[model samples]
Target: MRLLAFGDSFVLGQGDPDRLGWIGRALAGRPEVTLYNLGVRAETSADIAARWRAEAKPRLVSHEPVRLVFSFGANDCSSDGGAPRLAAAQSLLHARAILSEAARTAPVLMVGPPPMPEPGAAARLEALNEHLKALCGRLQAPFIDVFRPLAADGLWARDAEAGDGGHPGAAGYQRMADLVAAHPAWRSFTGAPET
Candidate 1:
């Protein structure tokens, strides 16, 4: 099996050890699977959508029975500034459309953006994640909520997050990987026998 991960620095495991990122750590010891990171720093949902066909599709081609993991939204909030909610919604809808198209060729997993540092931004992040979750449900794709688990008590802001308060360090990435691996979707993806 092969996993194609696309997103921003988070997927790249930015501040984490060896830059292994969460994807690298998550698939570790799973020799049966080959994982590829197509992450670009500071990429937004819209940006990912724009480049999906050109950048990500080629990787997906060789990885038959592809599992596309999408980690986005953080950059969108950072870039949107004070944009109106309706505008953001429209942009998200467009991004989802692109993802829908991609899903036709492979299974898709939508990972909600990780938590941010700014206190005021939580609401926006929540809104965006909610939209993403709904879109994933509509597409019959799996959705992973990374925000809530890392939001409270400076979970993503801890030292384990590498002092950036944004990207996660090794421990933080491990936390993320653990949560993701335990998620129902993950079991489905791996086709592991029920526990």
Candidate 2:
């Protein structure tokens, strides 16, 4: 199986070492699957919408029956300056459009952004996460809610973030990978035994 992970810094594994991004860590030892990281730092859903066909599609379409792991929303929330509700909705629509396009050639698994440590960002992220979950439901795609699990329990927030104060540290990325790898959709996709 071929997995294409596309999104922002989280997908790029920003806080980890060169080879230990969450995508790499998550797929480690899964010899049956090959995973590719197509993440860009500081990218928003709008950016993905604009460049996906030209940039992401080539790599994605090359992999037959591709499995897409889309991790976005954090940058969208960070950059949003308009009304929170409106901005989140707009971002969600953009994400939906990209997923719709990818679904024509691949199976999609939308990974919601990990929770923000900032005091005020959580509410906006909550809205974005809700919209993403709803979109996934409508599209019949798999959804992973990384926010809720990590937000309250201090998993990703347990350690100091990278220079940006947004991206998590190595431990945080590992937590993310573990959380994603344990998701039912991931297990089903890889046919791995449940945790």
Candidate 3:
């Protein structure tokens, strides 16, 4: 399987102690899957939407199943003094366009934005997660809610706070990897259980 992980700094595993980030940790031992991490720091969904096809196209190969996993919106939810960096409506519109184009060729799984250590960010992230869920429903894509569960967890919260006020440490990234591992979408994508 060929997997493409695209998004922002969190997806890149910015503060992880192991330096592997969540994506690398999640797919570490799986030799059958080839993962391309295209996570950029400080990028909004608009940026990802703009570059997804061009970035993802050449990497795709024939005779192999391709899967795309996106984790974004943290930057979008960030406030510039008072206003969000990317408006909620624009975020969804970009998502609609990106997912519409990607799903036509490969299966897509969306991992909603993780919680940041900033004040009032959790609620905003939750709202964005809900919006993503609805969008995923309409698009027939699988959505993973990483925020809801991690919002209340001590490990993720503490690690995120202790790190850089944004990215989490090794323990938190491991937890994220665990969540993705347990998800049915992971199972469906890998097909290891069936084999």
Off by over 4 Å in 2: 60-64, 80-86, 161-164, 193-195
Poorest 10 consecutive residues by lDDT, candidate 2: 77-86
lDDT per residue as tens, model 3, 57-166: 99888889899888899999888668788888999999999898899868888988888766666567678889999999999888888787887777888887788877
What's the true lDDT of residue 172 in model 3?
A: 94
Model 2, span 1-195: residue lDDT tens? 777788988889887755567778788788777777889988888887887667655665553556877888887777345443237768878987999988886777888888876655767888889889988999999998888888877857765354457777778888888988888887876666655
Which candidate achieves the best TM-score against the true structure? 3
Judge candidate 2 at residue 64 and give its lDDT: 59
Worst 10 residues of 1 by lDDT: 79-88
Q: On residues 1-195, what C-alpha lDDT tens digit does candidate 1 reach at each position?
A: 778888888888888867787778767777777788889998777777877777665666653567778888877766345653344576577657867887886787877788776655666777888888888888788888888887764556684445576777887887788778778897687553465
Q: Candidate 3 — which pairs collide? A: none
Which scores better on lDDT, 1 or 2?
Answer: 2
Worst 10 residues of 3 by lDDT: 186-195
Query: Would you list the clashing residue pairs of candidate 1?
Result: 13-21
Clashes of each: 1, 0, 0
Off by over 4 Å in 3: none
- Each candidate structure's TM-score, on Cα atoms with residue i matched to residue i, is 0.87, 0.88, 0.95
